[model samples]
Each structure stands twice: as C-alpha cells, then as structure tokens.
Target: MMVGRDVQFAVDKKPCEVGKPILEVEDLVVPSKVHKNNAVRGVSFNVRAGEIVCVAGIDGNGQSELIYGITGLEKPTSGTIRLEGRDITNAPIRERSKAGMSHIPEDRHKHGLVLDYTLADNMVLQRYWQPEFQNHGFIKKNAVLQYAERLIKQYDVRSGQGPATIARSMSGGNQQKAIIAREVDKDPQLLVAVQPTRGLDVGAIEYIHKQIVAERDKGRAVLLVSLELDEVMNLSDRILVIYEGEIVGEFDPKKTTVEELGLYMAGAKKQGEAKA
Candidate 1:
C-alpha cells in the first residue's frame, strides 16, 4: 500500500506481523585482511515479521558486503545475528539456509540460480533434499513440476516453455522473475533480497515491488538491499542508509524526505549510529 506526500491519514498505519520469524542483527562487524580495515564498520538493523527494511546507499560503501555478511557468505568478525532469537552470527551458510533464511544474491545469474538446471528444477533446488518434493528419498517428478508451475504462474515468469524452460535460455527479466518466484514461494521466515529489481524493466520492477509488499502484508520479514533510489524510497516502511559499511541513518517514510535520505546514503550526512 503506497501513500502520497501527506501520508499520515493513510491506510494501514499498523505494520504486518505474521508470515515468518523475526530477524535482528546486533552490532554486526566485518573485518578485511586485504584492506586492514573493517569492511562493515559496525552495522545493526531489524526486519520484523511482515516488514520490509531497505538498506539504501551508494555502492563501494559496503552495500554488497552487508548482505553477504548476513547470509554467512562472509563470516562476520564480531556481533550477533538472530533469527527468531537464535544466535546465527557464527553459523555456517547451510545452517542459515536451513534456519529458514532465504537469500536472493545480487548476482542472480551466478548465485541465485543454477544455469545448468531447468527453471522448474532450480525453483525447487532448495527443497529437493527435503521430503515434500521427495518421497522415500526419491524426487517426485510430477510433484516438482506442479510446485514449479504454481510459482511461475503466481510470480509471472513468461518463458515460452514455462517452468520446464532452461534457466540459461530465459531472458534476464524472466530469470529474475523465476528466482524471485522460487525464493518467495519457499516462504522463508526471513528473506534477504539483494538488488532484486536491478536490470529489470519497469514492468518487472513494479511487479517485484508489489510482491515484496505483498510478503510484508502477509507478515514476512524482508531485508532488502537495493541501489534503486525510487525503489527503496517507495517500498520501505523504514529506511536504513548505509555508508562505509555502517548504518548512518534511520527514518520513517512518514517522517523523512528523499533529499535527507540522499545525504545519509552518500556519506554527506550521518544522523545517528546507535545500537539496535
């Protein structure tokens, strides 16, 4: 639900609190042996049930590093990360995934999907090892196809061959759609969406935005990291502006200006760097 400039009298002032478990990061820090500096100086934030918190900032300022740190791709040097109150900071990547945290990496072509697999197969890749799509430790082909078809239609993937299409042959937009459709459909307690709408056309961007909001509406906690200024400004109920690997500002869209947001995003300003 988007609101205009005078958004106070808007609908649904109450935020959603359902879908999945809550995600909270406390004083997260990442060190760099290469640069001899903290890549993420000290970052902390929260993604509550049914809320989308967008991390807005310029690139080379640790935007990419932050998402990687959260997903266990890059182990943090310090701090605690919790999903539904379980400390996951030191947990391995697979553990985080099993804990119901799904991450759509920034480079979807490289990390989000497997080019060798068919779209339908890639859609259920996260769960192939699980029992729902498998029976007696054997993959149920028809059940897999059914699950993939449902997500493709629901998220609007429009390849000519539909869910059976090879991921390598799909258009960029369709690839993104397929990944989003799969990851979101998995219905994780915490969703790490990194630059999800980048390289997507306006229509695809719009569709993805609605889906993210829909997740929040359904009470899923989403940690969104995007370079699109308009996307972050429009979709985030609360904004966390990251600069130099640390969160520098926090604002309620109902109480902040885009210009003000730009300052924190660009490192021209830093409102506060308090603990979460």
Candidate 2:
C-alpha cells in the first residue's frame, strides 16, 4: 500500500495557443502478426507544445500498438513519425529518446521497469550512458543513488530498502510512481504516457495527474493514451476517439458529455458522419 497526502491542484482551463507541433504522426499503420488486419490504420494526429492531446478508446483498440510504433518498440507498416519537424519514422529507440521523447509504458512489469535491478539503477535506464552518470564506460553509482533519492523523496515513492530496493519488491503503486518520476524527470519535449494511472489507488492517481499537468504547464507536449473515461474527461484538453483502429471522432472535453464520447468509442458515432 502507498500513502500520500491529498493533492489538490486546479487544471488550467484557459485556452492555450498551441505552439509548433512537437510530435506529428501521419497516416500511421501497424500490421499485426497474429491478426489478419492491421492493428492501427491511417491514424494521424499532432501534439503541440503546451497541450495535452488524449487518445481515448476501449482496450484492444490499437492504443498499445500505436504507442509501440511511436516509441520504436514495433515497426509501423506505413507511416511517418516526426519529432519537432524532423522525420524520425525509422529512427532507433535510443535515437528517439535522445531526440527528446519519454514514455511511461502501459504495462509496468513488462515494459516500464526492470524488476531485478535496484531502484537507483532503473531510475537512469535511459540516461545511464550519459557523461553525468558514467565515466569512460564505468557507471557512477553514487551519482545514480543521489538522483534516485531525490526522485523517491519528491515523488513519495516508499520502499523497504529505499533506493537500494529491488523494484519488484515495491508495491504496485510505488512502482508506478517510480516510473513516473523517472520519465517526468527527463523533462522530454514530448511525454507519451499510456495508461499512466491504471490500477493505482486514488492518491497515486491524483499525484500522477498533477505531475502530467505540471509538465504541460512547463510547455511540454503530452500525448495521453487512456481507456479510463474519468481520466480522459478530466485531464484531456482535446479528445480523439479511436474505434476499430481508426479515429472516428474528436471533441473538446469541456463541451462533450461522457455519453456522447462513449458513442464514439462504441463506434456508434463519427465526427462528420450521420449518427445511426
């Protein structure tokens, strides 16, 4: 179990003029080895700096595949992924990370953390090779511990052994918190958080939500992929509803009702087509 103080922060509602696009996915298509058809088809969207654009849909609607493609875990059958106006469709995973992209993967155990590694080591998984954390191929263990301690304290990640704890021994909520701390601390230009608050307690949820909003306030573009209706409604400035691997509707969360959004998610409605 995780314990944290109640966090109350108002989401900024004032309309923000989105600046240059930080991420652009054009005509993205992902083929499935297990399925006959593509997992994602012709999906396109732009995430601008200082805005949070959410892709909302039910589970199994290509959200995971889309994230994999963007993060370079899986190759897209056809598409172009551009970061800050540079085409990075075929860039390697490390190349994308160095180009200012951070990901909080959906499956924490599978993709987010290396359970066997100490918390301090996992904290710098993406940056451990950098000059600050290494010297001529040797990892600066003290530097890693200091950085992990700061994040653990700041993010309220409690563990029996502190920074030395193996991540698998920590509670689920703390593990998620650790992932958030590590990814957010990177201060990436585009933060791709998929199902970030899933299966966590309310307190953890609140903390993570605030951190994501804080990122947008810092002029970072956020691409949120969540199936939770409440999270989609409360956190997103704009919502894109994906159904059967295609985006069928777009709405402003402030003006759309859950019932209407549900219609889109259920494939009962489309943005420009007549409702059945």
Candidate 3:
C-alpha cells in the first residue's frame, strides 16, 4: 500500500454542485500521424466542475493523442470540443489558454518548458504576453520575477540560482513543480494534467496529488490522464478506462476494484459486455 503525506498548503474546500458540465468532448476522433487508422475513435466524455475525472489506461492506448486533440496541440479529424458550452474544436493553442484551459503536458521536456530560458521566463511562458506581465510589447521583468518567486515559494520549486537558473539545469521534479506552479496559479476553469506525477519522488508526488485535489475542491474541473493505477484510485472521483482508441468503461473509483479496472483497461470487458 502507498502512503500520502500531509498537505502543507492551505486550500479552502467548499461544496460545489456537480451540475452542468464545464468541458465536453463529443464523438471526438484523432487520426494518427504515422498510421492509417485513427488514434482516437468516437471518444466522448464531460468533465464537471468540482470533480477529478481521470482517464486511465495502459500507455500507447491513445491517451496522449486524446489529450493532444483536446488541448489543440493536434487538430481532430472530427467531433467537437466544448469549453463552458463554447465550441473550440479548431481554436489555436493560445485561444484555448485564453478560454480558461491550463495543461500540464505529458512530455515536460518537449511541451512543458523552454529548456534554454531562465526559470523565471519559463514560469510565465503562457502568460508573459498578458497585460499584467507586459506593457507596450515589453515584458515587465520585475513583475515576472516577483511572480516567479511567489510561485516557487508556494509550490516548493527549487533551482540552482532561484529564478535565474536555466530550466534545463533543474531536476525533473523541480521542472515539473515549475510547470504545475505556472499552470495551477492561473486558476483555469479546466486543468488538463497529463502525467503530472510521472517521474517524481514520493514527496513530490504527494505534493502534486494534494495540489490536484485542492484544485477540485475549489470547484475547478481536473482531467487527469495517468497510467499509474495508484494515482487513478487515490486522486480521482471518477475513472475512464480507455482502450484501443476508445473508452471501454466508466466507474466510480470508490466503487470499483483495481482488478476489475484492469480488466477493462486490457479490453477484456466493456461497458455493455456481460460480466463473467
């Protein structure tokens, strides 16, 4: 059994109604770049405010493609992605960010951080162009530094030279922390955290888990795409098992066993198939 440490950060947990979905993906399809078949086929789901919905399956089951489609990193072949009832299927990356979406991408090196940039600069990669951090097409260096300092402290992000350290020089866990700090601090309506705790130490994993839970408690919808069953079982309120480019079954984490979930993830059982 895995044990989680006490959460150090203070977050207000309030009751939030699970009515009215905040994000909806209907009949989504994503074609593979290197293959003839679609990467994701007719996938559909809705994430409500104040809930942590996890997409759980083995690696290479199209989970990454699904996230890419939703985050606008890759255009979908067909179907609609609605955020707060607004169709943003074909919106650009910045537009999705402006539409209240924050993503902790699966590949931190490629999608999360600018390795050559200083820690402070990477901290504001998504928001540096905003009015708060820029004026007259010039970045407000001091403001950016201050903001980075605050996040580093709040999220326990460590680096060799504080905010001046090069991002590539930081450890993986610290890099992940910086990404989380930037994304979560934005207070986005929907947070797409794909493998947020992929390769972190136990302490870091515990802290990230708390942060995710804290987000859900604050009435923000979190779409967690993780292959770790422990994280799926511990952090999510609902589980979606995706297999062969499709969702095979949905379950309440509290009501489903890992063994049963494993069966669905392996394509041994499906939503309508009879249980033996």
Candidate 4:
C-alpha cells in the first residue's frame, strides 16, 4: 500500500498582476546542422514578469534549438533578444546570467551540473566570483559551505555526504533539486526552465512545481519549455505551440483544451499570426 502525501499539481497561490515583458525575442532564426536550414524560424515571444509562459511542442520540433538561441548556447542567424529592453542577441552566456537570467537547462548532466565537483563547489559555480564567495582571488570556503548547507536544508536535497558529496554520486532528483535551489536562490528576473521536471519521480516533480510557482509569485518571469502537456497546462499562464520551428498557435491555458493544443503542435492547425 502507498503511504505518502498526495501530489498536488496546482499551487493554491497566484502571482500578482503581470508586469511588462522582461524577455523579448523577435524573428529568432537559429541555423540548423545543415548550412541551408534554420532550426528556429522567426520565433517571437515575450515573457512578462509574474507569469509562466510555456513553449509546448512534441520533442525535436526545434524546441532544443529555440532554447539554445535564447540561453546563448547557440547564436541565432538573425533576430533580436532583449532583456529589460536591452539587446543581448549575441551576448556571452555569462553576460546573460549577469543580466538576471538563470537557466535550468534541459539536459541536467550536460549543461546543469559539474558531476565531479562537490555539491558545495557546484552550488557556487556561477556565483563564486562575487564578493560573498570570493575575496583576494581566493574562495571563501566557510561561507560557501554554510550557504550550501542552508540551501540543501531548505530545498530538501538529500545526499549521504551533505555538501561534500560529489554531484555524480547523488540521484537524479537530488541533482535536479540542487540545480533548482542554486538557480532560484539567485533571484533572477528571468528564469528559463527547460524540462525542469524531466525523469523525476512524482514527489520530486511536485516539489519542483511548487518551487517554480513560488518563483512566479515572487514576480519572476518564467519561460518554460516542456514536452509534457499536463505540465504545460498546469504551470503555464500562456502557451505557445511550436511546430516545424515556428510558433503555430498561442493559447491561454484557462481557455484552451489539450486537443486544440495538440492540433497546433502536430501541424494540423495554425493561427494566422501568433501574437507575443
């Protein structure tokens, strides 16, 4: 018999009124592996503060490339990307992060964590240069340890060795939690979460969902890319369906059905022009 709290997909809290767009992408066209084709074709959208906007599509419909363009993993062939009205289409990854963008990348192992590093070390990977964690070109070990412990406790990131545990030794859920805790703690203006709950158990998914919603309620703009329709519906205020590298339809989750979304995702239907 099961003996655990029921998983709740919906958070009881709602965000404050949505604010102006913090992330603006216009005519984003990422080049594909082949020289002639664009992987992301003229994708345009804006994510407002205090709202969750989801890019919903089947796997391999240019979702990965789209995220790459946004997060600086790949430069777009042509487009403009703005953060708080400043153009950053060709900015370096670190510059984007410094501009208040935190990315919970889709492939945790590939882009999220340094498996060989201790949990505490990985916790401050993006933040070590700050005065709090570094002084006189040296790491503040005690401060880092204290900070890591606090986040692990708050986020319930379980590991046998605590902060000293090598990230590779932890389970997938714990690793994901570590990433989320680190990213969310930064208090970014824009949180780009790509497949945040992929491969996690129900309990872990529940916890992560709550964290994302909590961020939204705190007035952070969230750009979520996911293949799961239920996650897209439950967590998003707005959904943009991407098919064949273009946005085919935009829907308000409260007003659209899964069937309608699927039709757009499958290329069976499309709106005349998907508004941002």
lDDT of every predicted structure (CA atoms): 0.81, 0.91, 0.91, 0.93
* lDDT (10s digit) by residue, model 4, range 1-276: 131878776655574569989999999999887556788999999999999999999998899999999999998999999999989999999999999999999999999999999999989988999999999999999999999999999999999999999999999999999999999999899999999999998889989999998999888999999999989989899999999899989999989999999999999898994556
Q: Order the candidates by TM-score, highest first.
A: 4, 2, 3, 1
lDDT at position 187, candidate 3: 92
Cα-based TM-score, every candidate: 0.87, 0.95, 0.93, 0.95
Q: How many residue pairs in model 3 have overlapping backbones?
A: 0
Of the candidates numbered 1 and 3, which has the greater TM-score value?
A: 3
lDDT of 4 at 35: 52
Write model 2 residue lDDT over 215-257, tens digit each, in one string: 8888899999998888898889889999989999889998999
Per-residue accuracy of model 1 over 90-132 as CA lDDT, tens digit each = 8888788888888888998788889978988999877787787
Clashing pairs in 1: 19-219, 50-219, 50-220
Which residue segments of model 3 deviate by more than 4 Å? 1-17, 274-276
Model 4 Cα shift for residue 40 (angstroms): 0.4
Identify the runs in model 4 with alpha carbons over 4 angstroms from their true place.
1-3, 11-16, 273-276
Runs with alpha carbons beyond 4 Å of true place in candidate 1: 1-21, 135-137, 272-276
User: If candidate 4 were superposed on the true structure by all CA atoms, what would the RMSD be?
Assistant: 2.5
